[model samples]
Target: MRSTAHTDPVLTQSGCSSTAVRALQISIAADKALVAEVRHTVRTALESWGASVIADDMAVVASELASNALKHAGSEASVRLRLSEGQALLEVDDSSMQRPVARRVGAEVEEGRGLFLVQALAAEWGWRYREDGGKTVWASLPVPAGSAA
Candidate 1:
């Protein structure tokens, strides 16, 4: 897996204007390899942003989202990580319109638990269709206190 990232100023949503901060985005390949790559990228990004406390949670959520995209969509995905106003946002874009379903699996089951884990880990999670024949699944996790975006 190969990725590229950059930091750019992002405007705040508050009515009062405020300073912008950097966000991270990476291009993800559509393969089983994406799972590890997503986890690693999330960890690295959060650590670099001074939010290592939430790195483990964010990485798990990212892996679940990216793995689902590659397994079901069969197309490359893009991941974006941003910290804004005390929240960490993660988005995974893939070329599939099929919304993810979270199923209740038995303890013995080895599959059908991805979305469930995502819902359990993320503060919020959802999906939206793109105009260009694809969709993006997004999750949000709160940034730890004293952490910088």
Candidate 2:
């Protein structure tokens, strides 16, 4: 695991370390209501970047990852978004050091499907131990050609 995220903007766990054309980040206390705010904020940022093509997907991925951090990590969680040339990167970090697992659940099940949703929507997703003492769960989605990433 990378000891610390780069200072330019604590980013990655993914190999796409290309400079971000645009970026934003925030940290919120563990609260269910705040999850919606994170979603909206991330969506707005994408829209401003002219990346409406992936707005909804980015919102859902952002909220789901935020929810996981709040519910599982049980501490303040931070989210970072980086739009590069070919992809939009979303990362959620929490104080807990434990890694996340993605599992398949039956349709009848109503819970434990957050990671599943992410897997379905994200082109690539994974987690890494943060040098500071937590784990950052990240996902990358393709940005269509001719659109700002």
Q: TM per model?
A: 0.88, 0.83
Give the distance in Å from residue 55's predicted Cα in candidate 2 to where it truly belongs: 0.7
| lDDT (10s digit) by residue, model 2, range 1-149 | 11122224334668566444677887788787899888988888888787889989989999999999999888888899888766899999999887788787888988788998999999999999988899999999988988773
Residue 121 miss distance in model 2 (angstroms): 0.5
**What TM-score should be assigned to candidate 1?**
0.88
Question: Across residues 52-120, which tens digit of lDDT does each residue of candidate 1 receive?
Answer: 888899999998888889888998888888876678899989999888889889999888898988888
lDDT for position 132 in model 2: 83
Superposed Cα deviation of residue 40, candidate 1 (Å): 0.6
Poorest lDDT segment (10 consecutive residues) of candidate 1: 13-22
In model 1, residue pairs whose N, Cα or C atoms come closer than 3 Å (at least 3 residues apart or on different chains), thus clashing, are none
